[model samples]
Target chain A: MTTTPTPSRPPVPGPPQDTSPTFVGMPTFHRAARAALDDTQQRRNLHHATRTIRDKRSRAVAELPHWEELRRAGAAAKDEALDHLADYLIRLEERLTAGGATVHWARDAAEANRIVLDIVRAKEAEEVVKVKSMVTQEIELNEALEAAGVNAWETDLAELIVQLGHDRPSHILVPAIHRNRREIRDIFQREMAAVGRPAPKDLTDEPSRLAEAARLHLREKFLRARVGVSGANFAIADTGSLVVVESEGNGRMCLTLPETLISVVGIEKVLPSWDDLGALLQLLPRSSTGERMNPYTTIWSGVHEGDGPQEVHVVLLDNGRTHVLGDRLGRQALRCIRCSACLNVCPVYERTGGHAYGSVYPGPIGAVLNPQLRGTESDIDRSLPWASSLCGACYDACPVGIDIPELLVELRSRVAGDRGRTAESVAMAATTWLFSDPRRLTAAQRATGVAGRLVGDRTIRSVPGLGAWTNARDLPNPPPESFRTWWARERGGGTREGSGR
Target chain B: MLEPRDDVVPSEPRTSGQRVALFATCFNDTLWPETPKATVHLLERLGVSVDFPADQTCCGQMLTNSGYGSSALPLVRRFVDVFGGYDAVVAPSGSCVGSVRVQHRRIAEESDDDSLADRVAELGPRVYELSEFLVDVLGVEDVGASFPHRVTYHPTCHSLRMLRVDDRPLRLLRAVRGIDLVELPEAQECCGFGGTFALKNADISISMGSDKARHVVGTGAEVLVAGDNSCLAHIGGILGRWRTGIRPMHLAEILAATEGTPA
Candidate 1:
């Protein structure tokens, strides 16, 4: 192997420590994946949850005769929106402002949290009730709120389970997918009292009972909350409307009950018009949670007089999104509707769970999205691209038809570029050189055959740099003679035989 | 019963005078020679002339997938050069064909080689996986082959999803006179031999392979069949280590078998 000499350069210090307390000290994907593999309960929980969701999604998608057409339309709409994102955002801002909603633009997560906090403090509210929003989690908004002396109460049942347990969410649609009924019951029994009304003293390991306990507890917070925070599924530019689809009614309660509503939406969530909502609404529910339609799809065009929250504020969050959108090859990640269907069907996510991804957005979409959204400066973000096996399941499941594997390859090339010359690069270079000429490849194959003779006809168990391949399986014994050599000897030197008889 | 989808091309026997070149892929060329031999035998039996192009090398799937697209460019150019003149190029592996058809254009575009991209676009459609060539190109389902033993077919992910060569393999297997083809439970899931993925992420790869092996063994079939040798090698390796009585065979081998010479 010809090693490319490393260019002489001054040694640089490592990437700065992630000072954000919520995701601080998170391990890289390789380490966290190893740890997660040993957790059999988490594995079981993930396997069960993903399998159930995948089967349901397949069934749900099968019911639509025009599903493929709908998927194409959804993908086309997102592409059009992404092509004109700046225009749509401006129009959406104008429409929302005209409809009696105040809009705030944030360049990053810190600015977004600061805007939301200012709004809360101005109202003199000590607490805020929240609808489960991935953008909020992505920005670690709850941690910021808590640090600023405001308690944020999660109203989504699964989100409540995760909050009460002080555990990170492991799935997109089902935040508590890592927990079973028994684990959820235990979390509720141990941690509910500190937050609000205690769980029922007779709380059992039944799912319905656990849900009821959560419902009763969140009801108290809902009635008294003066401020509500949310994330939107889609923001319509034509009407300045925001839509949130949820199985539970928490989003409705959060949108309607509070005196003031603050929505923190990613800038990429805007659609060109209300006409785009039909395909997406059909795609999202079937792809996520595998329902014909979600129970509550609340659409609000700013504030309705005395009907919903009288005061509404939409925080248009950039938060590294513009950087992602700037990438011509990678901007399709912006087309994600956050359905979590990609996660449900990804084998890597099934095995390692979401925490291994080290980002709020996990699974196949995260593998591409997180690396670009948060530059690959950190180890976790760098490792995220390699998290997938490049299976096309995510692309198949994605309602918007994001070519996730292609994006993954693109991101991998970027990550590979930063490393300059390394062992993998040298090896790949050598392999490429060998294959460039058939003669060189023949010689290499002959050498490999000679090496195979040293080990005989038995399966070898291990090799350097291939511990991963041999850890659970054995490598095949190489054939004594390569087909090229055999063909040369037996088939008159690789020339075509006679034509069809 | 799991019936074949209507989209699957019907196996109507036709004598095609088309000349074909075999891009036997580096894997079958180096390690799994039986796959290429079987493919040659099967194609020849169906009355289509087959040529083994001597200068053909790897299709650069391994290089491209390992984040070495720049390194894979020459191989792509070389592939088009070697097989560009043929009426059709056939390979035993779906993944290599998938790389050639789907990823080669991107690699060319990445380097801004318009000629290379145009060449790939011209040659991409002519490359075919084994079952696709038989069921779609040659329009033959029962290649007058018979394997008396029961077998289960694992649809490799690339063939199932990337190439969308759905049910073609199953249809071919079903038409074999004496073969009792059983459905592999959750057969559409990947066997985790994602080329370098098996090496870079060994633990996950092994876990996935073991699950696949268990399902294959559960079917009580004496042999497990698949189109791609890469997947067969990974799952076959696990089965070998576990001492399972089942053996992994390429689809070409199963399709080439006849009552007179059982594979």
Candidate 2:
């Protein structure tokens, strides 16, 4: 592989520290989401992009008469892979070793980053170009490398914008989906010159010009960087193959041009056979980009003598995936392909954007997946489950049939179980006490009716300590007489319930 | 406003012997009695006798959905105990029936009583949202009701996604005499009244609800109807706040209307 000189910079720092756009200490989903709802420009951007993609995805999915079957098949394959995950992983390691790729096991993000940093150090490389990878973001690999004084340049167009703009990915498939084209143009004009090659001085907000600038800035780095890092869409055990699908060909360059290549893949990404990829390949493109097929799908197995990278290292990362797999109901989240179909259709995500989720994985999937992957100990993780309105839109749109609404409720229960008594919990307890028996409910309703008579049909605009709802929307006063009271007094003859059996 | 119809005359000649119970669903029972009252009027007009089980109160959906599955257990048993014997249990709310059909069994499975689980499963199919009961089980496209006004419908998320009750409400509304039924843009979207979700995540809820309100008002229809009253209350609250001169109505309320009935 061709190599060029590393750009001269300051000396390196010690080990990796957690500096990769940490979502830590974010406010609760309600508070954070409430704040995000005020950004009108960002909301408009999300509205346009999500609506366009959602419509296109629906049309693309509808073209195949057996689309539902394909979805089920995709789900079944992931389920099977997860069921026999240990076997597949062991088989994958053996096959990868035999095929000339070295396999490394990482129990968590720190171990995974250590392995990657060691490889870069062994190569004596100063910088490594990277393909767009969520696992890398999840593990904060770039921040780790940067802390160790190694430059990890992102090559994907959206990723490059996110990196340069110093912004976290808002959507999975479209990372910078929260920014409109004009905003992207501004980011490119203002930020590119500080980091690398300067943008065209008279650059207008044309799409082609922006892409050209990105291409121009990335091409030299691709040819020069001696090391590259990537994450795979699917890792097949039978053939010991890693597949990276992308719309841009930058992934191909990153995979091949670098002499030493390292790939970080989640253990849950393992599929038993290449045969399973057929249905998944169909489902992912249609669900994510609304494409019949991704423009570029690179399937690499270890190394060729002189054709591709001379050395290949694959990191099988557990990174709390096993913790997620242990829960019966929560385990279904492992079936996700990161296609982002749920994000496009979620009304809450459309309004608040993905930052409100406080994780790289945002929208409905993030709400369930983050809590499982990173336990519910953190404020953000605990709040993630309640971010959704239980609309079931995510479940219907999910290609894997994950039943996200079911999982959200399950996670909510898990969160509640972990907490001590609070005002909300006490209120819930009181409600349960009141609702358990019909007589109790009747008594409460009678009291509520007496209160209702005092208020009549007047609206309550705001209530202190209950302003979460009343501050936004007015509430109708309760009716003076409840349905059961009316029924008991008027339809007075028979207790048609068989008197509670 | 909703006085009980003491003059019990079955409008249609046909009558079924199926024992039916009305589950007004706690929210409707307390806040919007007009919905259940209309349901009673509509069902009785179609010659199907209705019964209100005095022991029936809440379906425990609010508890279960609010992450209090254990707290919701007593009501779960209470539901099966009171309505399990009936041939059909009808509710004016889609979300309540949806909870009965889906979430109750989930919570019951965790309760670890195989018998209760089995009974919950058996009862799930018998539970029907108002639109489903009126359209499918009753096998009536036309209830011979008149609603002489322009109306648009918002299919609540539970009815649209969970129950997959596609076009049933539309089919029912289309059959109403003198009714000018207009289509709503993004009608299938949620009104953001996710039970306690409004209280919990209120800003995002209001953001979503206002968009739904904008669409409802943009339709230029006098009434915005939906299967769930909670959603109606939320969207109606926004309409009322904006002084849009439009009001939200439940599907049962519109279906129960007739020439002699008050609008």
Candidate 3:
């Protein structure tokens, strides 16, 4: 019997090549932000959306007299979880297995996608309905599934809008924050049918009508799908439960309707205990959608014989998290609850919108988090650190109290270190050298004053490299003599005349 | 020896017997020497002894914020050495003072120099931005200065967020005789003068500055006043380029004004 030479068991698909957009080739923040600034409609849409949310968030937060206490507890809880992340994760896996769910660990995005793909392919499912999952977006699971001929349907209203428009998410909580109601109507009319059920031809630009169209369009997909994909807001280690907070019922539909359920969660999402949910739940709703309590709070632990998804799978994703945790100062970014409060209040984000950040994550948190998670390896990631004006607004608005400005500064040092020696570095070194000795600084100031004369006026309307400054403002004509010079001659008893005044 | 500029006339006689050292920041010392001079005049007028340590240079904020924390170490050491002898060190610019108070220790710690960190910690509280000194330390809101102009105050982000000198400049401005202190729309927003932020991300910086200039002009104010000249230089540069008929003035210059010397 010629035994068919057993083919080398197809080399277990080594971590499905990470297909997630790393924003690898995107232009620097300055270039991208410039383009974003010129888009007046996007600016207007962002301004309205952010301002509305900012006001609502303020009111929601103010309703709780103990909001600050809640923030402290929430922050402390995350810090504890992060400190003992390995222990908590192990406990979570054990509890999940005990509760009848299959647990898989993915070292990176590629691994995570491969695990999910293997599960779906095993079930012989052609399509999967999805809840709004930032982690899924981070891993680009839908893109992977599509490449493998499995369709992933986004059921959340905003996520559906983004999916239908074939666009990327901008804001963390509201993925379509850059699109106004009219824009949504146009997107629905143009793109809804290509994917699934079409929007009513009579649909107006009114928000309710647009939402209704999305609801009808997504409902068909949610009921027929035998597979569901989700991301958890929090994963409880003690009980092996996953919690999802949402305003709409789409998360509920997707979480319950499918026979085979798969959840791709960040390892950082695991809480040490179920009790930690109270503080996070309270903090998240107010900070994110500006609701005192989310309309839908779904909690599920593995499966029951007759309820929910009978075959449940949990894909624990690492995907750059371990590297982020390695940074002592930067690890604080892990405490983030994906609340877009920082985005709403950030002036930079308000103007440039989320697209400028060039990541699934955007705004102040993205500025720090992306660089750490992705490693300042690309132009976009390197430029993310300088995207802010060191505004502390984000820090104040953060529910978990991440010192975003401090992290931005810290990450900037890393980015600078990677570049070795640029003109800015050389100039900084020279300036520091001049500043090390007061006499040298004084001499430099004298030189600058002499140079000021070459311009012939006390104001310079233009200068090379400082065109950003001179483009809109004028540089003060450098004083003929520096303060030290005036101080030495006049105040310090040196025999020299004050030149100008 | 050269004397104090003829443009500066002491508004009030010195008598309070509080000794203070002037930490004239690098930006003020180089581009706007008049700001520190005004700070000295205002402090001395309130009966405080003001000393200028010749060894003092930059506060190292520019270096630290620009991602050269190590390069800022020598300057941080120089700062502590030059001003550590005094009971209190006052700088005119809120941005510089904010850096000295907030970033100096972090810069030292990041470099793993525990001694420098300790020095920064001990000395940080003693260093005050000008308005902070006038209100928190000296316990004087009104310096009996006179500036008859419709002026609006742009609270620099460092001073507003870092120093928390809210309403101190206003209280001082409110007390100034003949000063029309109008409120600036969105006064707390940054003027986009984030040290090198302007040079590096000039387009965004200009966009932010233009908004500030529009608001300043909308208020019909003759002058835009702020505690930090760095912010003023940015906003003022925009206003100057646009010729909005409004000029940016340092808070110290406004506070130093007297009936005899109109700012």
Q: Each predicted complex: what DockQ?
A: 0.50, 0.60, 0.47
Instruction: Write candidate 2's Cα lDDT for B1-263 as tens digits.
Output: 12334333335433377899889898898888889999999998888899888777788888888888888888888899989999999999889999999989998999978899999999999999988888778877777677888999999999988888899999989977788898999877778889888878888888889999998888899999899989988999889889887878999999899878855
In candidate 2, which residue ranges exceed 4 Å CA deviation?
A: A1-21, A496-501, B1-15
Instruction: List, residue by residue over A1-501, the lDDT tens digit for candidate 3.
Output: 112222222112122123246566989998999999999999889888898999899999999999989999898888777777888888999999999999999988878999999999999999999999999999888999999999999999999889988899999999999998888899999998888888899999988888789888988898899999999999999999999999999999999999999999998898989999989999999999889999999999998999989999999988888777766787779998998899999988888999899889999999998888777778888899999888588988899989998888888887888899898899899998888776677778878889866665646787887666677778888878787777777676522232322
Q: Which lDDT value does model 1 have at A279?
A: 93
Candidate 3 pairs with clashing backbones:
A458-A477, A473-B237, A473-B238, A474-B237
RMSD of 2: 7.1
The local distance difference test score of each candidate is 0.86, 0.87, 0.85
After superposing candidate 1 on the true structure, give the runs of residues whose Cα lies further than 4 Å from its correct spot.
A1-20, A463-465, A496-501, B1-17
Candidate 2 accuracy as lDDT: 0.87
Off by over 4 Å in 3: A1-22, A452-458, A493-501, B1-18
Q: TM-score for every candidate vs. truth? A: 0.94, 0.94, 0.93
A385-481 in candidate 2: lDDT tens per residue? 8888899999988988899999999988889988968787898899988777667777777788997898876777876777777776777877898
Model 3 chain B — which ten-residue stretch has the worst lDDT? Answer: B1-10
DockQ score for model 2, please?
0.60
Q: Please give the RMSD to the true structure for each candidate, in Å.
A: 6.4, 7.1, 7.7
Instruction: Quote the lDDT for A67 in model 3.
Output: 94
Error of 2 at A68 (Å): 1.3
Is 1 or 3 the stronger prediction by TM-score?
1
Q: For candidate 3, lDDT tens digit of each residue in B21-51? A: 8888888899899998898878767778788
